[model samples]
Target chain A: MPDEQARRIVLASRPHGEPTAENFRLETVPVPQPGAGQLLLRTRYLSLDPYMRGRMSAAKSYAKPVEVGDVMTGEVVAEVVASDRPDYKAGDLVTAPLGWQTHGLSDGKGLRRVDASSAPITTALGVLGMPGFTAYAGLREIGRPKEGETVVVAAASGPVGSMVGQLARKAGARAVGIAGGPEKCAFVRDELGFDAAVDHRAHDFAEQLGAACPKGIDVYFENVGGAVWQAVLPLLNDFARVPVCGLVSQYNLAGPPEGPDNLPTTMAAVLRKRLTLRGYIIFDFAGLFPDFLRDVTPAVRDGSIKYREDVVDGLENAPEAFMGMLKGRNFGKLLVKVAG
Target chain B: MPDEQARRIVLASRPHGEPTAENFRLETVPVPQPGAGQLLLRTRYLSLDPYMRGRMSAAKSYAKPVEVGDVMTGEVVAEVVASDRPDYKAGDLVTAPLGWQTHGLSDGKGLRRVDASSAPITTALGVLGMPGFTAYAGLREIGRPKEGETVVVAAASGPVGSMVGQLARKAGARAVGIAGGPEKCAFVRDELGFDAAVDHRAHDFAEQLGAACPKGIDVYFENVGGAVWQAVLPLLNDFARVPVCGLVSQYNLAGPPEGPDNLPTTMAAVLRKRLTLRGYIIFDFAGLFPDFLRDVTPAVRDGSIKYREDVVDGLENAPEAFMGMLKGRNFGKLLVKVAG
Candidate 1:
């Protein structure tokens, strides 16, 4: 029998700095039937990303802020349980921006059908998903690492960074990963096949990073942007490219950090080195989605590009998992298994 | 008979903050004779650009710092008085990196013959030369403003900024220039044909800039950084491109300005707006010089792209003129008339 009740996590209040459990409210509602041209989607896997932190704040960003009562924004791998649309049918897997909800009613728009035969349906939210595509697009368009060039990415064990390292290696560049702990660093170095992995939590991280990048860094995929950026700045070679995807390190800050005013130094380095720092969101490269899938799906399926997930069971635990992910507690592509 | 003695400005001492006459020593030396396969060149017009400030410091930059006792690095429009090479360049005008000297010796390797018949030889140092090429290449490669988009450039009356404003207009973008005072602002808006102009010296400079760029800035040709950048930051529209060629305002600064750590704010804006901030030197686009000449030379000849030069007579006055140019004392392209 189909479950009558659906659960969703909504923004209860805006975060001042770090988002807490109180900021997210879990509520239960009756699963509504799909009317004309609508599909009833049952969430299978919900993707939790660092960018969601931006949406939780009232401050202006690329995406709209989630209001007090609205569902927290996220992408989800789901099953179409019932469909009135011509393109979708019952039992078909698809990915959609259905928020942090177990069930959602979609009017058959912006829903991408996920092929369950080639890979695990959950991969639709991860390795062959938005995070993976982000690394690919940013690198191809901006980073453009040449052979023997050093390409560095933080959050190394996470989906985006993992993909970035692997892609850099494929381009014949030296891939360097920066992760929080020794375990994640080992995984990035061993499992992901990056040339080197440095633990950002290490006391002498900057020195260790310098040691790892003997030739200096040519491409730094900037996601963790505070001290990591400060460390990477001096090591960046002339004509280096920095494709800024996220600033996870600075995302939780309620205000600017204590100052020596690093902007002048940053600008000076940029001018002297002829560096290119371009910031872009995944949606900006939406047109390349088909190309990304064509290239990455095969790589993931053939075991050439590997991905790991840290799955937390139950929709109610999303806030905790998300908060943990922000602090680098979650080890890999963070996901919430909402339902079967 | 050719003069046996020539005067050259040498870097006597490095400037701690802003450069002064004491830092430059007037050295009278015998004119260098061209050896086998070399050419003896007499300086005509020496370009005094803001980039020279970087050379004055011992700090690591794209170009090697000019050592103390060495002739200060500069580009000059010169006359090839004698050539031993097959090219036969006697009395031919050429533009070369001949430093701050009245006469120089070149191997003809990097010498490009200047066409004196087409335009005034001084134009090769101003409108039709390196400064103009800096504007063209930076805009085409980085600050690509589309039709009706707002483009802002600081130091509007100067060589680089003037060309940037005119090029932006040619691309059908609304060019808004920021100069030091009312006279320069009036020149930028009325004489240079910019859509609007704002004086950076005004008390309400930021507000005035905001008012000038009604639709917000799409392309910001950043040559003058510091407070000007702070003002433009909030006004940059989504996907705005900032092609950073120089940071003249901060060039003389001994250390970082006191602040609330604007880097985080800047990074946040870059991420939210998906902005592109790229820094480049003119040599990076040297291959595009011919393309630049083809596009700009005709327009300059037709009076569509007007240029003004502030020529300071005699090589000895170069130090004073260069120091004054840094403080925005010069009304146009700052040049030192070395020989004639």
Candidate 2:
């Protein structure tokens, strides 16, 4: 038991505006033994998502904020190190909400066994997991892009957006991707096979987007909801569907920006254009996981659906990686390698 | 030709903000004789709707704005005075999009014969017309309130909002109506049978709305977007459906309001609460007309659905009545009596 020490990061305090390293603290403690009907998990890979930024703030959101002095909550790919449960065996690869820790004890609830042979173990934390399902469900349920329609997605290099664009193309709709720089924009167009790619950070971003969307945007996958949303709003065609998954640009804002308020304008556009703007979390469509796997798994396996990963080694580095992801710094599905 | 004079109101100038009487010009012209395949229509009742305010401005909207010096466009109930078409005859009551003229010439393409014996001919302009169908379609198609859920509607004394509250009640849902004044609030509560009514003009309007909706708002029929929309936004429950039919309050704005903008807050709320905000024009759901007529016609016939008309006499008074309707001055369905 003395040798079974768990290294973990805990929330030191809630963030104001942008998160700093001072908000987190690293600690080591004796790993608790698995009780009856429980299993001991050793974290292999930790998912670092933009949503975790929301969990750091005390602000009201879909999920509760991670409390100060507690283990920062997250999903992790882990291996069963010890088991008192008959269903779980030692050395079994699995995925669970194990937080920012090297070792965790679970009562075997909400744990899904992962087949490492079918795909890499890290894919369980990225393309084959929550991020992937978010894109699948939001597109299928909300976006509903008909053939020959134009589907625009910002943060196009990220896991959710890449999936959305590819899925749109698969549905016979034109896919337009918006990214922060030339490299990511190229990746989104050349590698991901998007119909068009526009650099959001470019001086002529809005103009480029307008030119890209020749038929007007029919389905806009809204994740970055600031200037990108502003650019997409006017371009949206009548009866366009917007699947509002995230607002990464506004996550760090201390307060609403100055205006000439655009809320009325947005609502006016919504009314005049007959647009449908629907927001959703992946958990709401969890029942469609099997269908998502069925559709995406084949496309992914056949190389029609491409994925990229930006892995930052060590649980200690998760804070920096997550903060970077919020600012569009991470190139893809960001993950933290919790163990060697 | 001297006896066949037609008096009409035309758009003299586009209003920069709130419209004025100077923006309209009343003129009498010799009525153009009906050509082959056309019918001469003498307008009986003219509908003055909130949407007409949008038509008075040169701003881009779902429909083209009425050009300056053109007859201000609207729907009207009329009697066939002369027919060159085989289908229509003299004295037959019909509905057509005939603008603000006392006389009009139609090719009979969009005319629907109104059964004067079935219901009040005025009902064709109010409860049984575009306004009624708007409420029916928006509620049934977008709001989709389940039994026992809470449905909230603003401008609840108006044609559309009144119908929405009654329809929500018919569907076994709690209907909370928000109206401008005490009298209108009382009318919404007692006369219209809403579960609760909150006065938007009250100092403690938001607090009163919170008290009225103990379970939170599930469906908000958004026709009046401004302060009322601001108050209702925070009260919306997770997965609330907002069928945005109008924003009469913001229609008169020359430009966007000063802020602390709330657009990000709205988008964030949409994401956090998983809300669906859909905007629609009545014509978008025109296919549901027969269904609307079938469902609502009987309800009105049985006295289960009630209607009130704020009828202003004389076509010359249309500009004044329309201006009043925009300011929420009219008590119910505002209309102009064009003929004796």
Candidate 3:
């Protein structure tokens, strides 16, 4: 086998508290060779998300952890360097599970070629990818926002949330976005065309959210669950639907929150309000993906749907970017540029 | 309007803790007149449910409360004395929203003429009426039990819980019943054909529940929702569905439950387990009512669905019957037999 260098980020150590640089390792390894229907690819961009925090900690989730000696798992945009199958050829740009590595060898499985002419190749990692699909299916299937109703989502500047707001607007519902900082909040309202934006870090977040949603929140796209959930619950209309897609706020917690539990109160509200709270993994509803891509792709092309990418240059800085993501430091879709 | 002697039970006062005889007042009044399309029903049976307790109180609910001067709201099986409508005549047995009274007038609007030839008129107040319809729709629509899966229901002695268990069995699932005392637990197992029955009042209730179902709970018909919910949550399997019909345990609470809140833990379970929790009023899904009656009516006539009615022979006995029903004092469906 011919030896070729591939830059990789391996999980060095599992996180004890908030993740640090010591938890990830940068190394140069031999580029893998394609066998059978496999393809040799060079990764252009690696997606960084808050869910990776769970993968880092060895906790049980929908997906398994990135083990100590394995490359950190992620979705990537890659250019085919070589191919052994008739479906693909060298120079074809594709979406693959390349992780945080410069070179990836796929056995011709779970690889889909992306059309860079219609949209940026990087978008296949953001608005046209998993995050985008998450927003599309969650809103259409679970949230089921009707015209003139209000749909509130946290992490508004992130890819999933940005698409959630745009798609909600396309469906004729008023979109209310919530973000951490003033800049992101402004971008959510002015740049993203959200009807209203609330800064969660602000002291009057609950009040602001209430004011922004005059008719009460008919649908709450749950991503950041904690105080955001607490503030949102009271404002939810009767028969409101909560599509709990993510809970990034509590991901880093090693144990249950401090005492004075309000579970009974939450339960009572659920009964009294006749609410529907559903949690789902994306693949559980794979039958809806084709319809989702068909619905969201056109909106992206016409600029009716907008997305932002927070690209951090280099695989070595992934740890810092990930840590920043957890703390709401990264703006829009946090991605690491693994190779040119 | 001709006056005819009739005995009635009125809400004398609202209770602070649990309801008592003093909260209700017995009185003699003139029989209500039957106008056009109306029937005068002699109350043979009046259902005493936990929901009636909510109506007796001044608290907010999906339905309005019974004012201090008004008669309590309830369903009653009656022998018609006179009717202004062409379809009814004297001695024709019917059912309607006939409060705790010896005789009352009902417009033909919501009244369904109970065919004594099909089944006894009293069945309309038990397994063939509101409680029975509730179990059918909730089980069929929300529970949607698959073959061999386990469905758990508490308050197994009551009409609603009893129907839930029987229907679950009919749907080809194992039904696990939970009741307060040993007698009701035995009844659930011996009479209802439950796979196993656990005494919720037992010190080892959780352990007993765990032992009852080897495969774990798939669908939980939520009726009693305080300590029982706490115990059942840990036993819920992945992708389990909970149909929130009623929170009987927390209905009487004047305010939020006392400290040591566990909301975060419950939400965490929802995320990790991918659980779906939905709250619904049976009538809100009134679309299922006709279908409910069509399916369960035959089951009732053929004795496939057996129900025990605890007849409290007088309007004055309603408050006591209602209180006892809440505390699991009634062996079967609690009812008030207002008149001969």
Best-matching candidate per TM-score: 2
Clashes of 2: 0
DockQ of the candidate models in sequence? 0.78, 0.91, 0.50
lDDT on C-alpha atoms for all candidate structures: 0.93, 0.92, 0.85
Interface RMSD of each: 1.0, 0.7, 2.0
A140-221: candidate 2 lDDT, tens digit per residue:
9999999999999998999989999999999999999999999999999999999999999999999999999999999999
Q: Model 3, which residues run further than 4 Å from truth?
A: A1-7, A12-17, A20-22, A27-37, B1-7, B12-40, B56-59, B82-87, B103-105
Best by DockQ: 2
For every model shown, what is its TM-score relative to the native structure? 0.97, 0.99, 0.91
In model 2, where do residues sit more than 4 Å from their true spots?
none
Sort by DockQ, top down from the best: 2, 1, 3
- Cα displacement (angstroms), candidate 2, residue A246, comes to 0.4
lDDT of 1 by residue, A1-340 (tens): 3668999999999998999989999999988788888999999999999999999888888778899899999999999999998888899999999999999999977789888898998888888888999999999999999999999999999999999999999999999999998999999999999999999989999999999999999999999899999999999999999999999989999988777888999999899999999999988999999999999888998999999999999999999999999999998899999997
Better of 2 and 3 by lDDT: 2
Displacement of residue A28 (Cα, Å) in model 3 is 4.8
Which tens-of-lDDT digit does each residue in B1-340 have in candidate 1?
Answer: 3668988999999999999889999999988888999998899999999999999999999889999999999999999888898885688889999999999899886778899889999999889998999999999999988999999999999999999999999999999999998999999999999999999999999999999999999999999889999999999999999999999988888987776888999998888899999999998999999999999999999999999999999999999999999999999999999886
Q: Per candidate, chain B TM-score? A: 0.98, 0.99, 0.94
Model 1: residues >4 Å from true position, as ranges?
A1-3, B1-3
